[model samples]
Target: MFKKAFFAGIPVAILCLGLLTGSCQSTGTNKRDKEGFTAIFDGKTLQGWEGDPTYWRVEEGALVGEITPTTLLKTNSFIIWKGGTPADFEFKGSFRITTDGNTGINYRSEQLTDIPFALKGYQADIDGKIRYTGQNYEERGRTTLAYRGEKVTVNTQQNAADPESFRANVKNNAWQARQVTGSLGSSDSLQTFIKSNDWNDFHLIIKGNRLLHYVNGKLMSDVTDNDTVNRKMQGLLGVQVHVGPPMKVQYRNLRIKQL
Candidate 1:
């Protein structure tokens, strides 16, 4: 009887060992899926960022920027990330804003010498009213590259004698270089996905000359920039508080994965 019982237990022990090995493999695969991403914000302090102290701070685990009734801004200010210039990358974050807030995330940008913490490049625009949220606005650059719910391609004018002259002449008119390739959805319908006065997930996939923006897992804008003179391939990254009425904007969970 003892010999028979011992022989039967051997099969059960082998089956238990196989199950444990399978569980360990699954955990390792999950870690591998999240391997490349690097968190930019520490969530407790502004260690790797710079901006005007009067308007920017770390509050309740979020990077907060506010313009009070007394502290109105003369011009737009930005809190720039000191991390390496990411050329081809994926960026992810979340934001919440007041009803009248105007803020944006600037990437592939040049820092202005005249104004402290001023940047000019592509912006992922956000507003409390959701009017311009998810639009691609070039901050102090070519203005609107791709509005919400649109896919656009930017081409330089071949016959223009001067590229700088051409850019300045059509600063407000992006139609000169932009061609609508397709539509993602209606702007009003996309707005329904965003949360008012609550945190919403935002993502940007920028590779080569193509840039894509998404909000709450929905594609918001797409742009294929072929303009060599005006478009930037790599530069600094920052978040902005626009020059407007008293408003507040907060950002959290900032991370990047370089491609």
Candidate 2:
């Protein structure tokens, strides 16, 4: 299932810590207001990461992901934040989505083969506008574990009904929280909040055998890493440009930690 090779996945998951939206967030275990941590992005330019900044851009002070109507941006570049790879890495941060549609971030991935998940690993569940806030569902693969309220049904095809009812719960055009974490090939896990045209904070934790998804600073989804997820491929991360609704989503304060 070998297809293409992404850029040389970078190492040193840099830390972009500071006051976001004037909340004075001391991210990182040491705290952003503390010491011994390094800054990954300066919030001015894309210096360390290398790739087609076509779909991704620096707007105002956030990493805005734009998809021009008819055009979509998909890259084959390994854009590293600091440089190098981390054996036990944990990526955490928040994104402010402006549009209310489908979009996502891909990580621990490699080349896309004919069968899909070629070098594919795990995808944090960001679909289903009908679910509650900050839910992590597996896409394109088997789900180790998940939760669906009795009122909600997860069909055999994994489809849901009354999605509009669920969509109504969204805060609309605001900042939410999201997170995804996992090791490259041999481990994977992801998490995200329900769809909202707003900003959300996320923290994804991934180790050798465990993957956790946290939304809105709450541990919403959690599961153990499996052999099915730990296959081949070690590619860089990518933000999605969905195919409907002429939508727009912005991701900012993206930071990853190496364990």
- Tally clashing residue pairs in candidate 1: 0
lDDT of 1 by residue, 156-248 (tens): 756433756666546554546789999999999999999999999999999999999999999999999998867899888899999889999
Residue 132 displacement (Å), model 1: 0.6
lDDT of 1 at 188: 92
In Å, residue 211's CA in model 2 sits off its true spot by: 0.7
Tens-digit per-residue lDDT, 1-259, candidate 2: 2234322222223332222122233444324422322344546666555433545567776766555665443332223333433334566666655444455555555434343222233444443252333333333333322332111112222121235432332233211111223221111222333335666777767665455666676565554433332222233454554445544566677665554
Pairs of residues at least 3 apart in sequence or in different chains that clash in candidate 1: none
lDDT of 1 at 152: 96
Worst 10 residues of 2 by lDDT: 149-158
How well does model 2 score by local distance difference test?
A: 0.43
